[model samples]
Target: MKPNLIAARKPEEAATTHPTILRTVLEYLLDKGVQPFVGDSPAFSNFKRVVKVTRVEEVCEELKVPLTPLDDPIEVNGEIFRKIKISRKVLEADKVVNLPKFKTHSQMVMTLGVKNTFGCVTGLEKSSWHMRAKNYDDFANLLIDIHRIVSPILTVLDGIEGMEGNGPTNGRKKNFGIIAVSRNAFALDDAICSFLGIDHLVYTVKNARRRMVTPEYEVFGSFSSTIQLPSTVSTFERFSRAFSRFFVKYPSIDKRRCIKCRLCEERCPASAIDISKQEIDYQKCIRCYVCHEVCPQNAIKLVRKLI
Candidate 1:
């Protein structure tokens, strides 16, 4: 099973999947005579540390399952890009179980099942996509293309506790207290959008609609919450391209809170951050917010230039 273990943040932060859920699913798969393994490639953090901090390793230990990082990349062609490298283990698996957290994303409106599969891209290679996709819609399309090839049979969304306001990491924990299962990730994400009253606000859902990928599905049960999306999430459907740069939010370092970890500098695709000086070169910056996403201290703040 692949779960969203993007960082070493605690399970309480809702940044990653809880170990309890991983265990429950692992046991069920074991009972079905399925040889299940747990794997993911965290974008910035070390895989061993992320698994340990999220306690996913504990679950794997208890279940006697093989827990490993998604390594040994193999090339595959997607509809959008050729020779896309994915973990060879993923392609060789008989069946895949996708487990994604319910969280608001600074780039995409939400990170659900489809986004979870992106973890298959293998470690730091993910950073380059941020530079290439360049926009929400393109990134959404890339995610969808990846989903098509790594197609999982089932997806279980963990909504019991979720992140809001600049998440996947670095956000507030929200108690949504709901769980959902689906056969199709696209439909699952679209349904959640309807539930959250942001059906059209998500670029993934919008592009999925255009591509006719999400099939019709009925949403059972109910959930209600006023989610605090990313600080700059308003840019998605509200403004014209010409004005987006003027109004779009960019990352700024709060030097007082920064710890000089250099993660922001190391992981930034644009090489715009200099922790020594606590500066960002906006001219070179792609506004990917990787610095903000990778920062452990939450020192990166979102600001608008007004120019």
Candidate 2:
């Protein structure tokens, strides 16, 4: 199940996929005589620890289903990415079930079905991709390539409670209360984007349109809520190099809120953050917002480079 457990610690927070949904899906699969196992590679800690914290371990135990880390990377050369490493367990699986949280992302806009497959890359490789992809569109292309490879048979979105405003983590948990299912993830994402009135906004949707992977689709369900774009979205819209020099949005540390946990420094792919002195080197910063993504304290804030 692809829950957004990136920085979640509690079930009540609804930051990740609700455990109830996991249990229900697992039970339904079991009833259909499907030998299903749950696997995800979280960016923060060990898979077991993260599942335990999110209370997913209990459900898996009670259901007697295997909960695993999508590890042991197997190299696969893609059209856009060469020697890309992915989880062997996932590669060997008969079919993948895309269980994504309907959450807004600081970098990619929304972490929908197409974006959730990034978990298959495993371990630090996910972080390195941020460095390898030179810009927003590049990163979206990487996600698309991986999604095409994973090729999940079914996608079930946990849109019951959506996260908005600087998310994938550390955002408001909204009650959207809708579940979306589709076979083609691209179409599913496209439909959601259309429903949210942001078909032109999400990077993956834009890239999918360019590649023509997104097919004609219709959204049946009706749900309403205003999505809050990430704070960085405003400055990022001006993509021109000249505009970037003056209006770039960068991550800044809120020292008082920071507990010196060092998660951001340890996980920074660019190695731009120095938690010891509480500073980030702007020249080295890649604007991946990874520090913002992984920060447990919500101490990282996105600020404009220029007034």
Candidate 3:
């Protein structure tokens, strides 16, 4: 995707990184003599270019910290994935500090620290894994496997500005006004979920709990209203109980809102979306919602697929 085309399509959420908070962390890292490389690969190709638009590059540059692009891929020889490529910097890191914005995800239910690491996979490899897994549960397993491999030393949830609705990317930003930190992502995510009072059916949450990946965690702060959940979160438990093939939710594009940018088509891991026709083929869609996440115009909507 073109860097100019990949601009932040919506208004900046108040809960996004505050200069003071980010500076505080950077100062701490610098004081500790920790050489930090702050960078993230966006949902599309050319992360170095994408970061330029996010303006995160400016922050890193001002902090005098190196912004490392996760462009170089390193093959991961692991169970379930014979040859999955991850970012070289992640592998080289002595310690990984996971910083994830609290957002409700269309597929994973929530994009917490565990799900945030998916960015480390580099560009199209992220889409390839979705196509390979093909099922949400299997995809969740793939995420868990990658997390185990990367094994971030710390996880910090930037819930001060969180997103709900069809998110991780395209959603209305809410001021969640909370920051959570934990050594374990699973625990931190669970704590965040509990604080939100949302259901526990999140794929990463379920998988993490089942594998006993979460240690004891606690929530300190409180919020007035409960966070709104994405429409796709309901299928978590029902997915295993019955077929409900027709009851599944699928991503639909709003042509009026869509700029015909083809971002959805390019980012779709299942290759189920055809922007030319302005339709998503549910038969091929794994409901991964990568299209929804990357759509620069917020054109994609999750609607129930009626039989």
Query: Which candidate leads the pack in TM-score?
Result: 1
Candidate 1 lDDT, 35-104, residue by residue in tens: 8999999998889999999999989998889998998899898898777789998989888899999998
Q: Write the candidate numbers in order of decreasing TM-score.
A: 1, 2, 3
Return the TM-score for each candidate structure: 0.96, 0.95, 0.88
Among the numbered candidates, top lDDT falls to 1
Cα-based lDDT at residue 15, candidate 1: 91
Candidate 1 or 3, higher lDDT? 1
lDDT of each: 0.87, 0.85, 0.71
> What range of 10 consecutive residues in model 3 has the weakest lDDT sum?
1-10
Is 2 or 3 the stronger prediction by lDDT? 2
Candidate 2, 37-140: lDDT as tens digits: 88888988777788998888899999999989889999997668777789999899999998888989988988898999999998999999889995999999
lDDT of 1 at 25: 87
Clashing pairs in 1: none
Could you tell me the TM-score of candidate 2? Answer: 0.95
